[model samples]
Target chain A: MREMIKMVVVLTVLSSFSGGLLAAIRNNTKERIEYQQLKFVKGPAIRSILEGCSNDPIVDRFKIKDGDVEHSFFVGVFDGKPSTVALESFGKGFGGNIGVMVGVNVKEDTIVGVGVTTHSETPGVGSRAKTEPDFTAQFQGLPLKKEFKVKADGGQVDALSGATVTSRGVSAALTDAAGIYERVKPQLMEKLKTFAN
Target chain B: MAKTLTQEFVKGLWDEIPPFRLVLGLCPTLAVTKTVENGIGMGLATTFVLVFSNILVSALRKIIPSKVRIACFIIVIATFVTVVELLMQAFTYPLFLKLGIFIPLIVVNCIVLGRAEAFASKNSVLASTADGLGIGVGFTLALGALGGVREILGNGTFLGKTVFGPAFQPFTFMVEAPGAFVCLGLMLCLMNLVGKK
Candidate 1:
């Protein structure tokens, strides 16, 4: 009992110390992290995908309402032109959940960028969607209007070397995003004016 | 005091190496090590957490109760993980995205918990700190070697730079899961062959 009491006291002290250090680091770095998130993932995405892009507000699922559910999105704009738009595609990959954000230029129906925000592919196999030719290269110049798919399914894109399931998952997500873009393409273009403001 | 601290520090590298010697952190060791860049990134993140947690636990060794020690260790480890996650996001955004859940998963890395319970709990602060550094370095070496072999064969690249001639046909299997085991097994054989046990 005496030893147990001593052990409890030790653990409490450790917890407090670790908690204090953690709070200190988080407080110090929070601003830098916010700045980076704005500068890199969201900002570069806009410049690459949108024309005459300057600044854009990234809207998560909160503001945008869906039919019965709200979805997440971000847009880039300059003057009045909707230069860039990003749509999230949540889909199942070979191993599990996959989330990809595809940035598109509605004017030319071309993809300005692709980023895998989340993935649970089978490590080296399916996860290569972020790096390899068969996945990302396919997005570089394809029309947002074209049916997104793997070459195996008679589309113009090649699937990953051994990750057909994941390849298919990402393809489907892109397809869904493309279709959604087609529907809201005009509204998104008009709404680009509000991105920076 | 110095001799006692020496034992605490030396054990992490020699007697209980996290990956190759102890076989504790096999997940990321097997998963992200296709390139030296990813492997080094993961190892360093692990080290950062290990060092911080080990020190915190050692500093508070006098008060933690045995029954709840494991739970407390995990919370402390998790907090350090959050710290590493934040720092990586700030300085290495690309690498941070690449690491994904494994960053949070460091809380489960046997090395952290093992050290907290095994060494830090009984050891002095200085000794635990040494252990943290030694184990961290050894783990980094193990991961670096694994990445070296994988990238050389599978991608024909070294540390994200090409190290092979154009004529070389990169072997695909060398970058996959099975290849991780093969490389790791051979590495263990080598580590054992030369290690001063």
Candidate 2:
């Protein structure tokens, strides 16, 4: 009994110490880490998607409550109007979740652009989703109401050669983004007012 | 004591070098060595976890019960790994994204746990730190060399820059999975030959 109690006590102390140390480090670096992620991980895709916008999408960002989760939306001003908004959505992919950033012109109900932010698809084949401009370019100026599906599934989007799964994954991600944009349109529009002035 | 510390440090470079002499921690070795940048990034992260875990384990060696030592070591090692993960995600977001899953996977890296058990548990703090430093540097060098070779042949590039002329045809196989195995096997064979001599 003594030995067992001693073992339990030792383990508890060790775990507590480790947990405390980790908590301190995490708290110290939270904001910087978040900024870094914005600058690097999601920055390029956001920039490419909202390319023509005069405002910096990363800096001109706001968050909205979405069913207990707060999701960020980047506002982009184009032609002197804060008319476009971009946000991320994820879909199941070959290896894992594929993250796609979709920019929407809420006023026109058309997409500004689409770019892949993160994916674990197979390199060279499935990875073409990120590298192939033609794939992502097709999403630009697309009607948000249009159902996104690969050509194989009787939709307009073409699948990457030899990477049908990844193509489908990307299409699904865009569909998800469209769904999100539709649901958040009212809230997003209200938030856009804050950036306008 | 000084001689023993030096021995522990020096041994990790050659006598007990990992993924070569010791034949440990092969997962990250295989996964991240496609680019020199990724290899060095992973090695340094592992080194951070390894060194800190070693020092903490050594400090608490006497206090931790024999029955629960493994659990205690894991908790310590996991804390450091999370710290690295958060720091990397904040500062090096692109590399953090590129080395995804592998960073969290470092918690289970046998090398950290193995060192905790074999050296830190039985050695002094200074010696364990030395051991961790030497092993970490050795691992970094090995990954850098492997990544360099694969990148040069597979893409005709060094760290994404074209090293070979535009006319140069890359050996695509070297960047693929089979290529990773073949390259590692050949390198291991060469190491064995040198050891024999």
Candidate 3:
């Protein structure tokens, strides 16, 4: 009985000590990990979409709550004015969800550029949506409020050859981005004011 | 029967190296040794966990009851692994992404638990620390050498720089799964040949 008590007491003490140590380390690293994720996972897409911008979009960011989900907006400064914002949205692809980063000029309500952030589509086929620039380039300068769809389903966007599903996925993600932009435009404008030089 | 501190430390470098000599912790050794950078990163992460866990286990050896000692060792090792994961994510996000699930899998690495059960549990804190560090460095060097061979032959590059002229075609087979097994076999054979003396 004494052995059992000692075992129980020792295990309990060890577990609690571990828990406390982990909690402390986690608290310290949470923000830095978030930033690192942004800088690596989503940074390339954001950078490409906001190309030629004066400010580092990854660093100049804000989040707004839409219903229960919080959406992050990366501010892009172009020609000394912080007028563009890049946001990420996802759509169902052939293999999995495809993440698309969309940059829009807040003042003009037009797309500055678009880039694919993440996807699990088939290589050499569906993957072209990310690798082939010609496909995503079509979205540049388009009005942000317009519906996005592949040309196959009677829309303005052209689908990648042999990759209709992935192209449609990208269009769907852009459409989702439009709705998200409309919902958060007011909050975005308010936040961008702080970055004005 | 009692080994000196220097012997405890030095033995891990060659006589008791984790992967090559002991033939333990093969998962990360096989999976992440595709690049020199990845191999080294993984080795360092494991080293950190091993050393810290060794110290903690040795320190608590007196208090932990034998019946629940395994549970206590796991808790201690797991806490340090979590700490390493968080630190890697916070600072080395790219490497973290590359290492991915393998980092978490380190908890099950027999070398860690084996040391805690076999050596740290019996030895003083200082001796355990030396053993861990020696084993960790040995693991790192072994992984780095393996990665160098694979990367150079498979990609025709060393640390991403072209080792051969542009005219050289990469031996792509050296980068695949079967190649890993073959390379490891040859390495084990070579180690045995050299150690025969």
* Top-scoring candidate (TM-score): 3
lDDT of 2 by residue, B1-197 (tens): 44677788888888888988888999999988898898889999999999999999999999998988898998998899999998898788889989999999999999889999998999888888999998988888888888998999998988889998889999999988888889989999999999896
lDDT of 3 by residue, A77-139 (tens): 989899899999999999999999999999889998899989999999999898899989999
DockQ ranking of the models: 3, 2, 1
Instruction: State in Å the error of residue A66, model 1.
Output: 8.1
Give the Cα-based TM-score of candidate 1 against the true structure. Answer: 0.65
Candidate 3: misplaced stretches above 4 Å?
Answer: none
1 against 3, candidate with superior DockQ: 3
DockQ of 2: 0.67
The estimated TM-scores of all candidates read 0.65, 0.79, 0.97
Q: In terms of DockQ, which candidate is strongest?
A: 3
Name the candidate that leads on lDDT.
3
Please identify model 1 stretches exceeding 4 Å from their true place. A1-48, A52-197, B1-16
Candidate 2, superposed: residue stretches over 4 Å from native = A31-42, A66-70, A79-81, A88-102, A106-111, A114-190, B1-4, B195-197
- Model 3 C-alpha lDDT per residue in residues B35-116, reported as the tens digit of each score: 8888899999999999999999999899988888898999999999999999999999889999999999999999999999
- Cα displacement (angstroms), candidate 1, residue A96, comes to 11
